[model samples]
Target chain A: MSDDARDEETVTVAHGGGTGRTRDFLEDSVVPRFGGDADGLAVGLDALDDGAVHEVGDRSVVVTTDSHVVSPLSFPGGDIGRLAVSGTVNDLAVMGATEPLSLTCSLVVEEGVSVGLLEDVLDSMQAACEAAGCAVTTGDTKVMGSGDVDGVVINTTGVGVLPQGAHVPDAGLSPGDKLVVSGPVGDHGITLLAEREGFDIEGDLTSDVAPVNDLVAAALDAGTVTAMTDPTRGGLSTALNEMARKADVGALVDETAVPVRDSVAATGELLGIDPFDVANEGTVVFGVDAATADAVVDALRATPLGAEAAVVGEAVTEHTGRVVLDTGFGRRYLSEPEGEQLPRIC
Target chain B: MSDDARDEETVTVAHGGGTGRTRDFLEDSVVPRFGGDADGLAVGLDALDDGAVHEVGDRSVVVTTDSHVVSPLSFPGGDIGRLAVSGTVNDLAVMGATEPLSLTCSLVVEEGVSVGLLEDVLDSMQAACEAAGCAVTTGDTKVMGSGDVDGVVINTTGVGVLPQGAHVPDAGLSPGDKLVVSGPVGDHGITLLAEREGFDIEGDLTSDVAPVNDLVAAALDAGTVTAMTDPTRGGLSTALNEMARKADVGALVDETAVPVRDSVAATGELLGIDPFDVANEGTVVFGVDAATADAVVDALRATPLGAEAAVVGEAVTEHTGRVVLDTGFGRRYLSEPEGEQLPRIC
Candidate 1:
């Protein structure tokens, strides 16, 4: 069970999340063992952008792959189908790709799954594709024996075309950049946890699972967005730390300025999970020019998915390659979650 | 477990193999509900080619997705990682895309598996990618509980560039096109089965699992290749019949002309399976212009993967939408395998 895993004997849930462990696993074991050391990578796994960029003759294409094994195929605000489409599309979106041209889906279904359930998931996928203005041009389906899979595993690969040099990466952040979050954080993670743990609440707290490519496009077109990332598995803190390290700059974040929905904040506190350490499916944190940060936030606020956009942090050169938190009382360094916090939240 | 399954209540292995039951299941249950309806598809699922073709701005791209779940991860001559890459690269090749540019791999690994085993598989993938001359540009990894999945599952999606109007489809076979097979058939299918079922074989027999893009390129460049498809799950019979049905042309195949290795033929006979009805991972059956069929055969024979290339059949106008076999004993229509003759052969 052991080969190059840092502390654990085998893979842990943190390996799938946006944490240092995932990076370590990829770097120490995967990157060198496999020949991932080629040239002309706009954003390789080391920099860890939302998507990988490849330069074609006259156009730069964004490609991203994601596997959705979210438990309880259907949830409060969305299902695995919606999550699969939205998640892949957002990866392309944060890379400054406005419209994803094509997507290829491969489904691994368990033997005993009902035909009706499969149809329902397909319908959800169709709806999500329509919302994002992307088409599922090719797909393959395979059914596994009952115990071979839990229920279903979906892998969606998306391709988005961009103008020759318009694509962005996490390393594009500079010292004078400002960090803006598109919407409230931790709603998706908290909602999934509550549903899985049977936490009843008065108001409906839905998963923040929606495609944000349109919002990203509007913001990129209207202002100067140097770099962007969508926080999914490892939440806001991990994402910010990744960007900061990639650009070799320090992040000065104002704790009070971070946007968190009331219900999500309450649920996160009740569960003993930090809001900034949880996942968000529909939000993007952008590092933009400080002078145009206000305009970028305003442009994002006009989009349906970004009404709560707010400036939460700024890139600084003081503590290079780190994320510093400025709370109301004192200051601290925001670090990545050490171990597995949640699993199968897509 | 029931919704629209014709007879069975849930999905079966027959749905994974390229059988009529799979077609019926897709048509009756999937297509009518999932909205696969659209236009500008040179080869869609209805035609049942190896991949789908899409025309972008000034170029055409071939897209294919396959999920590899071969048992025993490691086999006689190849492993799951090699199968994943070769299977995907071959799909793009037979669709008139002889050079695939990029591939995206998403892996769903079960917990408790050894990290050493994972590294071995990744090494195989590296070798296969080098052989195919394609880069795995984007990837995702997710881990599931021990009992949720059977070790691991890999989904690879490939994208290939084609000359603007040079793409081929299942319906491209004309009345007089010749059917040429590149290399021997059933080696891969028989080898996997023999290893899994413990059939003792003499004199070094292994799965013929290799990428054949170079051979396809040579043939396409030298002669008129109207349509082509790699014989994978349902083998030569299924592939030829699919092209016949799509093009509304009858195929006349001579049993004596089909190329089969002596070892594979003997193994298929012992196992009570028809050699032509089994899969071949590294073989392409081409429908080409009859006038230059011999030239196409010579060009294919020059490549390493096409040493035994031969002309096996021809498209005819009579008995439209059917395939007729002439074995010198008598004549019979070659129908698709009724049910799951070989499960997980791909």
Candidate 2:
């Protein structure tokens, strides 16, 4: 059976992306049924927060979990090991965490996976942990029968130290708030897609997978940033949609203002995929006060990961729960997040 | 090719089991190379601790991550969801945490997974989290292409709050300490094997999947328990061997004293498996002062999950780094954990 036909019969590729069927599944099935709780869970499925915050005495620790099942475990610029660390590190960082402290690494390997390959992955993990300043604290390893799993899948859970008396309100977006993105969009997604599809028109289109905790810290220090999200699986569209819905505000973004690397845009055009619908490994979208938007953008540009940061749009008062995009021409239309075109980007 | 013959060609079923190839891989490949670190990791690959413990301010918080890939999704008595939560919960509990505060559930689903099956798994996860007094805090879901992954794999990471001034040294076993099992063993492993091999056992044999935090709390409250471990992948034999090796002491377990259900023993014999080498989901092995071992066992027996708790062995000053078992026939020999008979039994 063809891929599309088979996907319609069960779970579709969109079910794993940031928007589309993934959000629908969580909202319609998983969230409504199991979101509420009596326990002292500071954050859970209910809020759709990047991480879970648990009260710990006078302070709180933000925790997030992501399964890294990227294909070609090793890729340009980064590997799944690095992606795993960077993914969780960015999650906590976007949640206003200053220090990405400790992490737990869980691994499930298919039988016959070479010992050398596993060690290489471990070396990558060690290096990534060192670079991100996150320690691998606890973990478990399980091997599956050769045919049961493909290669290896690593899931990393990170705990970050949120500064005392500080929280970047995910639901605090308001009219006139500015929207900003860290660096170029679609780099990681396009890179993975190129590798998968064997696109040969590539000149070092490496993934933008790196820890953004330092950038987030700098932005927080510069100004009052309200909703913060790393445009990952669903890219910018999903990130803006979440902020718009939770903050009960509309988002007005300029299509021309969004930063997309030239190579990535060309690749996206060739693959028939929209940049906004793709995934990213190291990127942050933030809503900040209009007054400090420029300063925050400047602060972001000073960082390595956010060097190409730009002020893309502003939260608006109309069209609550929706995002509207303005073309470079005199055209305005509702923004629709495309279905999944990239799977396992992180 | 035959199963055994094929296994020899690649990663055999033994690599996934608690003992045998799994330990060897970690020691030879994982430990010597990637184990040493400059980061102040409290628990890592070196110690082989079930969970990693990190100091969070005045007190400590224990963190653990496990990827549950149990086949059949729905087992006779428990499903993968319960196993996922129970496995990590037990890991934290055996480390001496009375409560597992928060859990993050990450899922990797195949494109062909039915929506109904996914919901059922989520429901089980919700129920298991509620039962374990842990909340599903934050999670990520990814879908792989058809045939990329088998069914679904759930990775759960738990964070537990450690009580003030309470530290359970997992390797600090004294010669005078007695060894105990929280309840009967081999039920989970034997049940899974029976189901996989289509063994039509006469009596009902259900998996003992559960959270043992309450039992650990009771035992810790009752007396001086030096170390605690719940026999999961490696069962009683592996657990004792770990304690013996880490504590640099010998373990003397009485074959008649070790508690094993008659049905489990019979099933193990019939299947050519050793009861001691099999896995147990809800059981814990404790090392306590000889004077307090009975009281600790009594405390354990008071709990519903530990109703069959028994004092089965004691730490010895002789034969460090080894375990000796005394057969009822008046013959004693070294106990060896068998090759993997059942994979994915978590």
Which candidate number would show the highest lDDT if scored against the true structure? Answer: 1
Off by over 4 Å in 2: A1-9, A37-39, B1-12, B32-44
The candidate 1 chain B region of ten consecutive residues with least summed lDDT is B1-10
lDDT tens readout by residue for model 1, A1-346: 2435523366666666657777776776666744364545565554456777766667777788899999978888899999999999999998888788777767888877876677778788888988998777677777778898898889888888787789888778899899999999988998988888888375578999999989998899779999889988889998898889989999999999999888888888888988899888899999999999999999999999889999998999988889999998989999988767787888
lDDT of 2 by residue, B173-246 (tens): 88979999988888898888888888838758888998888889899999999988888887788888889999
Candidate 2 residue-wise lDDT at A313? 92
Q: Provide DockQ values for all models, in the order shown.
A: 0.54, 0.50
What lDDT score belongs to each candidate, Candidate 1 first? 0.82, 0.81
- Give lDDT tens digits, candidate 1, residues B172-288: 899999999998888888888887778837745688888888888999888999988888888888999988988999999998889888888888888887888888888898999
Off by over 4 Å in 1: A1-9, A33-41, B1-8, B29-47
Query: What is the C-alpha local distance difference test score of candidate 1?
Result: 0.82
Top model number, DockQ: 1
Docking class of 1: medium
* Model 2 lDDT at residue A64: 89
Fill in the DockQ of model 1.
Answer: 0.54
